[model samples]
Target: EDCPHREKNGWMGDAHLAAEMAFYNYDVAHGYTKWLADIADEQRPSGEVPGIVPTAGWGYFFGNGPAWDCSLFLIPWYTYLYTGDVSIIEKQYPSIRRYIDFLATKANEHHIVAWGLGDWCPAKTETPAEITSTAYYFKGAEILSKMATLLGDSGSATRYAQLAEDIKASFNRQFYRGNGIYGNGSQTALACALYQGLAGEYLTETVDALVNLVKSNNYHLDCGILGAKYLINALLDNGHADVAYRIVSKRTYPSWGYWVEQGATTLWERWDGENSRNHPFFGDVGAWFYKALGGLRIDEDRPGFKHVNLNPIFPEDLDWVDVHHESRYGNIKSSWKREGKHIHWEVNIPNNTTATVFLPLGRQGEVREGGKAIRQSIARINIIRETDDMKVIYLTSGEYTFTFVNDQD
Candidate 1:
């Protein structure tokens, strides 16, 4: 439902984001595949994808933007990523290309496509609509290029790659101002720039400004629909996981916990209970829990469960985290706990699958697997690399319990 008091339709933006979690949490391939077909059937003759599938035909006349139109590219791309199914791309390729072409028609002389919803609902923001739309435009091109390459369409792949680079150059030249400043210092603008790699040489300054913006807001998120999905990951990538956790754990106004505190059993359409009480668009934080905190990642190169990435980040505030994802291959589990000065991490990789585990030891040298020391002579376990704080190990399918002392103390 858009709102309990308003229309209840399957909006593209909500479904696109919600689909991310569904693909991870449950077996949604069958239903999601059908939905993708339905969305394709609903496409207009002009190649405009509606904002809401099975609509009364309102969004097509208006309201559709890069953020909304991107569902076409995103759903199939994400499906391929999770299931390793190329047929979805094969079926949707033509429509996806047509839609991007439609978007190209909307671009101004500078290749800046700026006509869509920008950060739909934040209490306050300084990011502009042009920035959000153009950034997403760039993202769509980037994903389409990948999809083209995967489908063996070399010409389309090269074309989309060039298109993506052009969009990025245009976006940076128009929006970025050398330092952490982007179109009036809006959190959404800076976060989008950082998330999309549009900041270029200004990445460091942009990240610092983003952290300061979050800190200034008392560790609360100040983004809307467009920026919310990328903000947490951007923070995590830039060595700000602590800040991400703090924002997630925040229980005050305008936060996820705040909604839960207000008796929300499901995600709300807005930060405040001003509209629909049941919405999944803003509930992307659930994916962050499993991906960032639990550290269960599906390798893009090895899409599906063929190769799993276990890089759980143990926040100093949390004692332990347990996460299990049932991939197309099988069930993958990652659980870690701190007992005194030792960190015990246990992982379960499904049969016929391999995993790369990154265990945090914090400079402690003693590491063991199944009560046996992990050394260069180990047959099944390969110590890929050892940094100052973590050990990276490559392993085949099996249940393994690794123990190491956290030398931080």
Candidate 2:
């Protein structure tokens, strides 16, 4: 269910679509724990989770698909990632394994999942469930493989990892068209492939195609709740964060800014705002804001924000940004502003946490911290890498302010 005006059910698609934003904005993992228990306790004998939790024997046959069911696999993994506790994975291990087994039985010879809704309410284009669902099938198996590895079950890990690769092969055989297109040349399919790491070798080509696709649409988002986050990631991960910003900053049709301009204070059920006035399905943009603009990000290898990657990408037109988050470790802050040819950056890394901070600078520049030379700033800051336009440094928990004088750019 999307809103109280509608079914008000616990829709898995809505849950997982906003999972990232939820994790970053609030301490929702504890609350999600009991809900995850409900989801597992309500798992069907056939190993499929219903579209709605605590259902009355509905949503299993038609309302739910792999995309919706992915919350079972994806959310637990995210829980473990955000909390660094294996208990969540352990609690759902059996159900996860059984669900993947059931999915394996459902796949056709070509390993395509054509069941359930596909790309709910995409703007102006159709993406098949066969493509989207199977893509999620690959993701579920891939995540299971990693979870198995974390649990010290080598056999299951190898089995699921290999199964994921086989599913990938099947997906490419059926859906991948030449030159980085997935299915029907839709943004949904392309963005899914890029987000799930399905575009293994043609990653750059796929990113270029997505960029071209956005350009063709005049920098407006056409994806639904599902593809929006991944589309943002595909661009940000491939060095086109500016393009992602351009898409989200639009205030015309099919853009969130358009909704804001219309005197709306709540998220709409659709881009056109034709139905419900409050919805959380399209909240992934909040996560993008923290990651891309605020320079706050988490690492899989170092879960629970023990260590972080501060890789802020500057928007082409926006000259100032301020971001802060209270992660499990402590408060993390990053703020930057451009003044003429100079940049004033301030950051706060809480105690007992370390951060890898990246500074966007030109080849020739002078950097000073606390009004002192960066070289004399401390025994804490160490330059790891420097290049023509950027510098990378390692920082232990502390508050810092750095000023960069633009000499080359």
Candidate 3:
């Protein structure tokens, strides 16, 4: 149920968006895996997946678009990423390919498939539904290609890879113009293009335009439900963490802070609190705090957290952040604080696990671990790389304290 008081439907899009945060915050593998099985069982013969699994037969007749149907691919893919369990992918592969093939049948002459709910909720935007829908189509194909490669299905991998490339070319040809311009110049359209890797050569330009779009909106998000989840990440990935931080920390109408200001104890279904005040769909931003601000990430190559990556981003406005997660391997920890021009970072990597810690540094010779300068020959520590912005260090499982000075004034 999206909310206890409202229509208690199992909306697929909401589940897709909230899956990451749910896995990160809790152990939901058993329940979620069962739900995926139900979704697979309910898939219609026409290759159309219902927008809500275990449906009352309402979502099938309508609202079953790529944005809604994408849970078929995303949920299992994310499960594989988080848990390192390939059984879900193996089980869902047929249904996943069937859904993608169904979407292919909906493609226009340009090979851009577009038929779905663009961005649910009311917002001022000139972006078309086709852009968002087709972008998701491409995203699904891309993920499927990766899944095939992972499963050693070389033929399927090649097929889906080619399909993804074709879709990317079609998307760029249909929407992208010279520079950063996209269809309707809407934030959602641009975000999809950038975040979905459809921007190609125009990535930097698109990012700059996106930053300007947010600044033009006074640092307020302009995307609705579907695009909102990607907006913060797109901004942060494109060298605009400052803007991302500002948006998440804003306290006004159409912002998360607005809900907090209204004395609401939970994330609202709508940004305006127009409907159910307790919904977790739009709460994907919480994952960003853990990834970007708190700087804890599971290594994709070593999924199930066999290898941890500690890359904390210390925002200028934030003084300190503390984060911990209990992985199947062991407990992972990262705590950091800034006092004047110096930063104190403490990290704990569990036994039998290793980590690559990226410590922000202002200049060379500014980093010291356990009161000793980091060196290539240091025991259990190896300096991977050094740039003006950060010092990347590789460490075996152990507790370590590092200090660096901010030389920039």
Candidate 4:
């Protein structure tokens, strides 16, 4: 259902675009697991999924494209990622393989999938459906490869990895127009490519293009639901979170802040606040608050809250963020405040769990925990890795407080 009133349907695109947000904030394993079975039951024998589940034989040939169809793969995958439940993946394996085969049937000779309702409801349509569709195909294949490895099917894993590589090559060849332009170089185009791992060697340029696009828009969002999911993370993941922070903080038209100015009680169906003013299509932005702003993250190698990753993006002007999630293991929390070149961070990891805490506090020697140097703070915390901008420390379940001061951090 998209809105509280009017035309609430089992739209597949809505499910996936918001899937990550849902999984991050709530415990939805059982519900999504059963839904996966029901949705797979609706899968056509031709390996195609209807755009809507529980359909009365419609949506087979209409509104069914890579973006909508990719939901079938992502829903279960997110379930596994958040819950560490392999049973759902096992249950949906056959259906998953069939869906991948269906995508193959749709791909062109160059391996690009050009069909789909792409970047649905764009603020200013720019990315070609083909670009997002093809990238999603690659993402689906890559996830499937990881699934195969988890299922002890090394052969399939290698096969799908190869397929994903082929799709990536094709996507880059067809869409990477050089100089960071992808299919007219809309914010959605650069963002989708950057977030989907399709940017390859041109990642830096792609981020620059996305940043420039947002700047050109006066820090307003030019993407709608589909591109909206990837846009923030793409910028944040590429070390340009300062730019991302500016975009989201804008209180102008076509931005979330404008919705606030409009006294929006909920997100609107469209950026301009037309149609249903309360809609879920663009609600995935909530996920960023928890993951990027709060810095609570997941480790693919240790799915669920079995292992946590804390990588906060401290906005330049924002004061602080406090976020916590009750994982299957226990409560996982991260809170941080910046004070004039100094930072105070507090983290709580649940019993029987561990975390890789990323502290972006300049050089390794400058960061301290409990009033001691990082290296001296352990028996519980260990400095596992360090880079120019961040010190990655591993710690066991417990409450920990860290402080660091560096103007350049």
Candidate 5:
């Protein structure tokens, strides 16, 4: 009864869970797709989806509003990218388009979409603009624009792209505080803008900012399990792949795994670095663990057999890893073991696609999978799986992985 904010459905938790499921287990495709549908059902006519559905009890968090609504727009694109189902995009297009239109109405002369009320709106005041909010806004609009183009809605595409560009320009002009740094929405906004390609020519600067954010632990404390997961993704996407890998693998107290290792069935709200169970932001920490650690990416661009880079930076003491993911294309299970001389790698990619597997860097060798001798060239190989068959590639020494369902193959 105390959870007046979210009751109708576990909105915040569900979004994070959807990302977890979509990335970790391939079997949950139907359930994940249905979850997105359920969310669309609750969307207000005004294009504002509450952070917490009334049915779920929790309405929204204190720091921000509308900022989370942008995730609603991302859900459909995430699904379509995996299933390659133009139908999903078509089904969600009208609603998404309407939402974008609504956001445009909210935009100021600067084309910057304002976050709701005082939530994260610059020093937590009633400022008209905020970097974090606009970052998500532009990023979402850009994705929607791409989806619109894919759906042949040139008008919507142009409109959304223009809006996205406007927001990006505004973000660079306003949020960037010099020294290749950014503020507002913490590093989360900075990373999202860059990873989503809204950073333009400033990718390196944005990437540097992301590194600085992680180093400074800005979002780390402000984030709960869910926020940390998203933060990790932003780092990985913006050329900080190595740092992202460290955040995932680090087992020190207060880490993602630390909570799981403490005999907790689900993820804890706060890390040991923060408060314990009494923390106000507590939800499901287990959800974020599998998602970020499993390296399950929700991409809107690749429809079949999406690109996966198996680069995990584990501590010297911690080595082996195994993960299984269920996608719209099908199921993929990957395993990696660090042998003294080489990494024993095995990947089972399902039917109807090809996987470009990257052999360990600097290592040289040929391995077999799907009943064929995988050719090793330039320390990487493209393993193409047609139908129910599989494709496997071997690696030498150093570090390496593959990009499955990529544009190249």
Candidate 6:
């Protein structure tokens, strides 16, 4: 219902809609991707798509149109992961390339692509000519490069990789703030660049800076909705999962988990850091907590790809943490027990590829997929040489049986 003017309002602008679909509540996210496909089809000669589609009576807030900024870079990646449709990728490549071309033209003399801060952090008064803008260009280049590799554009992949490298060099030279923080932009964006590998050698230092910044600034990064989602992910990916978890669990008036604790089904625009009653946006809330904090990661590299990494860290004292995810591959029903000694996971692999299960030490396991028995064994942990000589199983992605124990019989 977010993009109601398009005649098909069921799936439009429902970012958290994916979590619902994952939980088997409904397939609203799927429908939303369909709408994205429709919008992708209508790109101009420049291949740019509007960020928002206007609906009658929806007004400017609802009809913000497409963004010619970094947000545009996320479309192709999001599309592929949610739907696992490669044909769409091929169809959208030209438009994506046009976007790349636009960036190439915007590159500074140092070949760094600089963009004005758009739709990310507020109070980020720095103009387009600032470091955040260039960082945006760098981040976009990295994404486009990956999309190209996935689409079989080896030539373009190489080109974009080179461009990304150049941007990294430029970012460090121009944005690196010698005190372990990247000074080119806001702390959140800098953390993202590092976590996503866009920051190259600057990764560790940037993360250190972000950690300190959050702590010193009282965990308030002056971020908006768009920026908060990214900041959290960056923290998780860079091995600061604990720090990231704190933001979600911080009970201060505006922390992420604070809203959920307040009985909110969705997230607000700003946190209590900025204001206690500042709830401007409705669509932004539930989405981030479900995807990021929930640690719901779907590996889109393999379509109908049922491989998911379930690493959930529930806040202290929470009885149990659960997340339901939907993939073009199959359904993921998973939960975590913080107090449990061993990790437990159960999923239905999409019908087709065989699943290779990795068991934790001290936990012996047996699995049967499609009614066939699977054998298990042990291997050295953190060892240099590994052998698959331990165990093997064949599963056709549908329904299967999984049983494991802390002691081998």
Best by lDDT: 2
Which tens-of-lDDT digit does each residue in 1-409 have in candidate 3?
5767777788888888888888778887777789889888998776888888878688886877988889899989888877778898999999998988989888887777667776876345545789888988999999999999988999999999999999999888888876687898878888888877888888999999888888999998877877788788788777787788999988987788888899988988777788788787887898888888877876878887778788877777789998877777777888888898788888888898899988876754478888887773359998899887778889898888888885544
TM-score (C-alpha) between model 6 and the true structure: 0.70
Query: Which parts of model 1 are misplaced by more than 4 Å?
Result: 1-6, 376-378, 407-409
The alpha-carbon RMSD values of the candidates against the true structure, listed in the order shown, are 1.8, 1.5, 1.7, 1.9, 7.5, 6.6
By TM-score, the best candidate is 2
What C-alpha lDDT, on a 0 to 100 scale, does residue 69 get in candidate 1?
Answer: 74
Per-residue lDDT over 1-409 for candidate 1, one digit per residue giving the tens place of the 0 to 100 score = 2545567777788777677788878887777778788888988767778888777777886667888778788888888888888888889888888888888988998889878766787756646788988987898889989998988999999999999999998888898776687776777888888888788788899999989989999998888876788788788778887788898899998799999899889888778877777778887788889888888877999998789888877776678888898887788998889897787888899899999988777555778888888884347688899887778989998888888886655
Q: Alpha-carbon error at 189 in model 6, in Å?
A: 3.5
Model 6 worst lDDT run, 10 consecutive residues: 377-386
Model 1: which ten-residue window has the lowest total lDDT? 1-10
For candidate 2, list the clashing residue pairs, or say none. Answer: none
Which lDDT value does model 2 have at 196? 88
- Report the Cα lDDT for residue 258, model 6: 68
The Cα error of candidate 3 at residue 37, in Å, is 0.3
TM-scores for candidates 1 onward, in order: 0.95, 0.96, 0.95, 0.95, 0.72, 0.70
Candidate 4, 187: how far from true, in Å? 1.0
lDDT tens per residue, model 6, 39-137: 555445654444343233332233222222333445446556655666656765676678667667757688665443333324342223345456656
lDDT for each of the candidates? 0.83, 0.85, 0.83, 0.85, 0.53, 0.51
Candidate 5 deviant stretches above 4 angstroms: 1-8, 12-23, 26-29, 32-44, 54-64, 117-129, 216-227, 251-253, 272-301, 306-316, 328-330, 363-409
**Global fold similarity of model 3 (TM-score):** 0.95
Clashes of each: 2, 0, 0, 0, 28, 16
Q: Rank the candidates by lDDT, best first.
A: 2, 4, 3, 1, 5, 6
Off by over 4 Å in 3: 363-365, 376-378
